[model samples]
Target: MKILLMLRDEFYQANPGLIEDAKKLGDVRILYTDQGIAKDELIKEVKDVDVILVAVVKIDQEVIDAAPKLKYILKHGAGYDNIDVEYAASKGIPVTNAPGVNAQSAADHAFGLMLAAARNIPQKDKEIKSGHWELSMGTEVYKKTLGIIGFGAIAKAVAKRATGFDMETLVYTNHRDLAEAEKLNVTFVDKEEIFKSSDYLVIATSLTAENRYLVNQETLSLMKPTAYIVNVSRGQLINEMDLMGALEEKWIKGAALDVFEVEPPINHLPGMREVVATPHIGGATFESIKRIGDLSIANIVKLMNGEELEHVVNGVHSRVTQR
Candidate 1:
C-alpha cells in the first residue's frame, strides 16, 4: 500500500515521528511546504497513492480526479472543509477526520482569545514593552454573556470552560436539543438573539456553503459596541472585509482570530490593537497534534486492513480500495 502525507513544514518538524509511524504500514511519501503544497505538484504526488493525509491543502475535484487510486482521505485534524468530501463520496473514496482530538486545544484557544480581546492582553503587553505604562481600560469576562455559533465538540468544550468564569452561554445551532442545552447549562436562542445579547461572541460553527460569512454586516450591526468577537474556527465563517469595516467604524470593540479568510493574510487584518491574530494554532498544541496523528494513522490502518472506520464523514461503506 502507498500513502501520501501532505503537511506544513512546521507541523512535520514538530511531529516527525508520525511519518515514521505511518511508514510501518505502507510506502509513505511525505510532502511539506511552508505555504500549502502547490496544486500542480500535489497532483503529481497523489496520482498513484492509495491513501492521502492532508493538513490545509485543498482536496478539490481536480486533486480528487488526479488521485484515481486513492481509497481514503484523512484530514489531519478535525475540520474537513479543506477537503471536498462530497466529490470524494461520489467517487467512493471515503473521507474521515480526527474529530475530537483537538477539541480541548481549540476550546482553550477560543476562550484565551475572548480574554485577550476583552482585556486588551496583547495590546497592554506591547504597550508596556514600549515604555507606555498607561493602563488601557478593559472589560471583564466574569458573568458576561457568551454567545457561541455552534454546539460541536469544540463548542461544547468552550461552553464547559465558561462555567469556571460563571459565563452565561447562549448557543445557536441548526439542530438544537433542549435536553442537551439543559444538561450543559446553556440556553437555546435564535442567531439574532445571540448577536444582540452577547458581551463576547465566538464563531464555533463549521464553514459550509449555507453559512459562509455567517458574521457579516447585519450580524455586526446587532452586536453591542462594547462587545468583542472571537473566532478560532474557519476564517471564511466571518467576512473579513465586513469585519474590518465594523472594527474601523467601531461597530464592535474588538476581534481575536486564529484563522483568516486567507492563510497568512496579505493585508494585516484590523491593523490595530483591537485585533489579536494567531496563525491558526488552535489545534497546534503538542498533545492535540499527537492525538490527531494517532487517530489518523489508526484510521489509515483500518482502511488498509479493510476494517470498520471511525469518524467517516462521507459514509463510504464499501469501495474497491486498491493496494
Candidate 2:
C-alpha cells in the first residue's frame, strides 16, 4: 500500500511518531505545500497512492480524477468541506475526517475569541506595548445570553464551557433536536430569536450550501446593538461585506472570527477596533493535531487491513479493502 500525506510540516513536527506508525500500514510519501498549489502538484504525487491525508487543502474533482490508485482520502481536521467528498464517493473512494478530535480545542478558541473581541484584548495589548497604560472597556459574559448557531460536537463543547460561565445557552439549528438540547440545558429557538436575544452570538455550524452567509445584513439588523458575534466555524457562514457594513453602521457591537470568507482578508474594512480575527487556529493546538493525526492514521490502517473504517464521511467505505 502507498500512502500520501499532503499536509503542512507542522503536522509532522507535532506528531513525529506518525511517520513510523504509517510505515507499519504502507510505504508513506509526503507532499508538503506552503503556497497552496494543489491541482498540478497534487495530481503528480497522488498517481499511485492508496490513501491521502489532507489538511485545509482543496482536493477537487480534478485532483480526485488524477488519483487512479486512491482508495481513501482522510481529512486531517474535522471539516471536509475543502475536499470534494461527493466526487470521491462517485469514484468509489472513501472519505473520512477526524471529527470531535479537535472539538475541545476549537470550543476553547471560540470562547477565547469572544472574550478577546469583547474586551478589545488585542487592541489594548498593542496600545500597552506602545507605552499607553489605558484599559479598554470590556463587556461581561457572565449570566449573559449565549446563542449558538449549530449543535455539533464543537458547539456542544462550547455549550459545556458556557455552562461554566453561567451563561444562558440558546441554540438554533436546522433540525430541532429537543432531547439533545435538553441534555445540554439549552433552549431551542429560531434564527430570529437567537439574533434578537443573544448577548454573544457564536457561529459553530458547518458550512453548507443552504447556510452560506447565514449571518448577513438582514440578520445583523435583528441583533442587539450591544451584542457581539463570534465564529469559529467556516468564514462563509457570515457575509464579509455585510459584517463590515454592520460594524460601520453599528448594527452590532463587534465580531471575533477564527475563519474569514477570504483568508488573509484581502480588503480593509471599517471598525477594526471591534473585530478580533485569528488565522483560523481553532484546531491548530498540539494536542488536537496529535489526536487528529492518530484518528486519520488509524482509519488508513483499517482500510489497509480490510477492517471496519471509522469516521467515513462518504458512503464508499465498503469499496475500500485490503490489497
Best lDDT goes to which candidate? 1
List, residue by residue over 4-98, the lDDT tens digit for candidate 2: 88776677787877888888787899777645664677788888887888887789998888888888888988888999999998998889888
Global Cα lDDT for candidate 1: 0.87
What C-alpha lDDT values do all the predictions have?
0.87, 0.86
Best-performing candidate as measured by TM-score = 1
Steric clash pairs (candidate 1) = none
Model 2 scores a TM of: 0.95
Candidate 1, residues 1-323, lDDT tens digits: the string is 89898876777777877888898888998887556667799889989998888888899999999988888898988889989999999998899988878999999999899888888888889889999998777889999999999998898899989999999999999868677777789998998999999999988878889999999999999999999999988999998989988999999999999999988787768476679999898988888888888888888777866788889999886453444
TM-score of each: 0.96, 0.95
lDDT of 2: 0.86
> CA shift at 63, candidate 1, in angstroms?
0.8
Give RMSD to native, each candidate. Answer: 1.5, 1.8
